[model samples]
Target chain A: MSTLSERILGAPHGNYVDRKVDRAYVCDGTGMLTLETWKRMGAARLSDASRLHVFFDHIVPANNSTTATLQHELREFACNSSLTLSDIGGGICHQVMSEGIVLPGEVVVGADSHSCTSGAFGAFSTGVGATDMAAIWLTGETWFRVPDSIAIHLSGSLRGGAEAKDLALSYVNRLWMDGGTYCALEFIGEGVKTLQMDERLTLCNMAVETGAKTGMFYADDITVQYLAAKGQTVRPQVPETCTYIRNLELDLGDIVPVVAVPHRVDTIKPVQDLAGLPLDQVFVGTCTNGRYSDLVRFAKIVKGRKVAVRTIIVPASRQVLSEAVRTGILADLVDAGCTIGTPGCGPCLGAHMGVLGEGEVCLSTANRNFRNRMGVGGEIYLSSVATAAASSLTGEITEPEVA
Target chain B: MMQGIGHAVCLGQDIDTDLVIAGRYLRTKDHSQWVAHVFEDLDTSIAPRLKGAVIVAGKNFGCGSSREQAAIALREAGVVAVIAPTFARIFFRNAINIGLPAIECNITCTEGQKIRFNLADGWVEAEGKQYPIRPLSPRMQEILAAGGLVNYWKARS
Candidate 1:
């Protein structure tokens, strides 16, 4: 029995001695710099320009003079190479790629660690370094030593007020210690069939936190529908039989609103455990939980109420923002005293905008809570959109009550 | 055949890329500037001790973020090698590609303890105790011998 990863690799390499990826993509951060360095070093593209997808997100709109220069260089590279450039505010690389570029059964590699977010569509997506991406830019191929697959069979449905974020956090709590390091986490079973496309994206986006190569779900009817909604019509193949090195099962209904405390993504605790812990800020958007549905959930909890603490809500993409506006979710958020930021990765990396001060605490919907992730000397608590919105109202960590 | 002998500085698990070098410093591509801030957040005092020292860290030594700058900063700080129980895949590859030797070993070494590593033998000697390390693939070994992936690729082309 072959795993889904094996099936996809087999389709692309077809008995070749060395497994080669199907395509490669890069974001503005490392990819552009790597390409610029390559050009300076006298290397020219050796493959079709279409094989590369360039994104300018991480530091959109050029937060500083140095960043502006880097962005300018990226634009120049895109122009000179005749490659597709998803410019600033064009949405995060993973979001844009999932919505348009990445397809099921494809082996896609990107320079950003969260590239595994594309695995939501059943693609074998994983992160690589700039050098690897540069190599792929030249040859359109890079090798992969097939990774062992870990089977996580989730059953039951999530309890109200809990979300894919909680499920993902719980999985990290259980698996991050030693389970998924350098392994592919193939989520399966009844619960997998119930999660929406956005939720699946959230799950896969944080797979890197578990040290997993990629977190994937078998693309079924939901995936087809998601693609169909995007005007793509294709049936994605799923492997009939798969072998796993380890098997784990979880009940989604058992998951509660939880948060990953500061300094580590896996240091998780239920929201009830830390309720009333004061918060300095609350963020409602990022590649992990930034979607139209997430905004809607945030709006529902904060509507007709003023934010008691500093709060920022950023839609993952311009498309999500447009939808939020059309549905009046943006208005509700703005009315509730939350700052509405543009569609880009804002303070998730503490690069710019909404960075926290020393001795401050923030509950964010974004993935990853490593030390200094949001700002130096500030503690970051990772939670679901519902928890973040609820916490913003009380100025402290709170669990959303399901009525 | 390559070898290095240095004092070890030990750290805990999940010493992520951000801790190695913050994202704020990523604005500039200057390798030297990044080295100055290595472990700035983890411990302001660690960077000074990094030169010519071996870092002994717990599992997932370089985790979070795909910026090769983390590996570059460590190398620029004169870290001869990073010995960890495990490493995040991307960081490991970035280190090898950039000519930084990352050895995987589960042995414990005291801080400031003189340690020796033999790349050819794939072993680490600390406090007179020897621990076997997993050797890199032939391709990676060749790349390191050539001083990094850019040079390795340049040599081939």
Candidate 2:
């Protein structure tokens, strides 16, 4: 059994000096890397500089000068520093980190906040800023307040239309905006065992919504097999005994597809509740929903149907992209009027690609729906792969009405 | 109470730790590295005026990402305490846990009211008037006196 509370935070880790961490790493979403942002690598003060991984899951092809600079800097940094670069269009930060990099019971921090996504594998991960990243890049030491813990046990399996995304969203919503603030969410119970590693990744990816420092699901066989297939070693973990602040009861039932209407993520309502909400754009890729299986679902829907006018599909990775092409999913999407593009972190950052003009409404699979998050004054409605697909066909929010 | 060092006032939100100290010069562990860029965002007059002070700001002032540097920066820069309408929840906990004397003081004035705060008296003096900054309901005050959250954790351990 591993007793590792002090690993990510407590004492000075390994041979590094006692460098205190300020807060936690919640993970910033895609498009840039920080270690090279300040050029602090292999400084032993920062434990295992190579431990800080980089992947281009957000943007496959750097579209402009600034983004291109970021990409080039990463390549140069990884090569010069002898660090492992995970993705050349990897699916998403969480999945890539979980499939191999992190071991059970370890504490991980990323420059991205959703680094909490790695918690699904039983290691604690969160994000932070670049300066902090620079410090962590130099010395893996960080300061943590040791947040209160919340335990949620899942009992039921997800129905067809529900997917892990909806359940994850509902969990945060149930917790309310500040419900889980300053807490570590531990998703336990037999229901969690039913989820595929990919599905579990989706569940933990949104842990940030409730302001949680991290969300966790213990690592099991699925985790080992995934790593084994990639020729990586897997570690074991022991459960935490800390009492949870709140324990939610979740049983999988036939959940009708749901959509989070704009302005705030928790303002979500059923898709039928989204009637008459006209949209100008539809985006289908993000750290949350851009994955191989997610694309396959889109392909299933759009293959026989036309995408809503102006709808676009951004696969989470080039690997997902190549897989889509080889699997015929890409051809199906374009056949349905969907404009497919390179796997770059797009409008999700509210910076580039698929931006909605003022007053335009967009149906997106990204996490936040804050004003101007995707586009200034433009509205974003959050939904799952099935709902995004169904809404793409109608140019309005709609549910698949399927299991 | 604003007792130890009179309350401070740092105007505006998103006053990141970098504004407290630019990244280019923070390679040391001593608080001495702080004075250079204490208020890089606002007027440079801040450091000189902060012989002892507390900060006052608006809602979600510490919104966005978390950087402990902000706390260390403020603490080292000599901010005795912080008073805001509402905080980002994290910073509020952080400032208090680290022994930075942060309190929640409801302000009636719309904006820009300069006043005096007596930590010894537990009063907030502004707009030619005086208001109590305490009445923290006991448990809250104990946490504040213990010197912020992490210190409390260390003491407990």
For each candidate, what's the DockQ?
0.66, 0.10
| Runs off by more than 4 Å, candidate 1 | A11-19
> How does each model score on TM-score?
0.96, 0.73
Alpha-carbon runs more than 4 Å astray in model 2: A1-47, A57-60, A66-75, A86-91, A235-242, B1-110, B115-157
lDDT of each: 0.85, 0.63
Q: Which lDDT tens digits does candidate 1 get at residues A1-403?
A: 7777777776322232244566677877887657855653356755778778888778877888888987888788788878888888888888888785678888899899998999999999999888877777776777676678888899999987889999999998888744677788898998988899999999999889888889998888999999999988869566566678889899999988999998788889989999999999998888898888999989998999999999998888889889989989899999999998877788999998788899999999999888888888899999999999889999999999684
Q: How many steric overlaps does candidate 1 have?
A: 0
Give per-residue lDDT, candidate 1, residue A5.
75
Clashing residue pairs in candidate 1 (N, C-alpha, C atoms within 3 angstroms) = none
Best lDDT among the predictions, by candidate number: 1
True contacts kept of each: 0.61, 0.06
In the range A237-311, model 2's lDDT, one tens digit per residue, is 556554555788877563456777756566668777776577788888876887889988877877788876687
Best by DockQ: 1
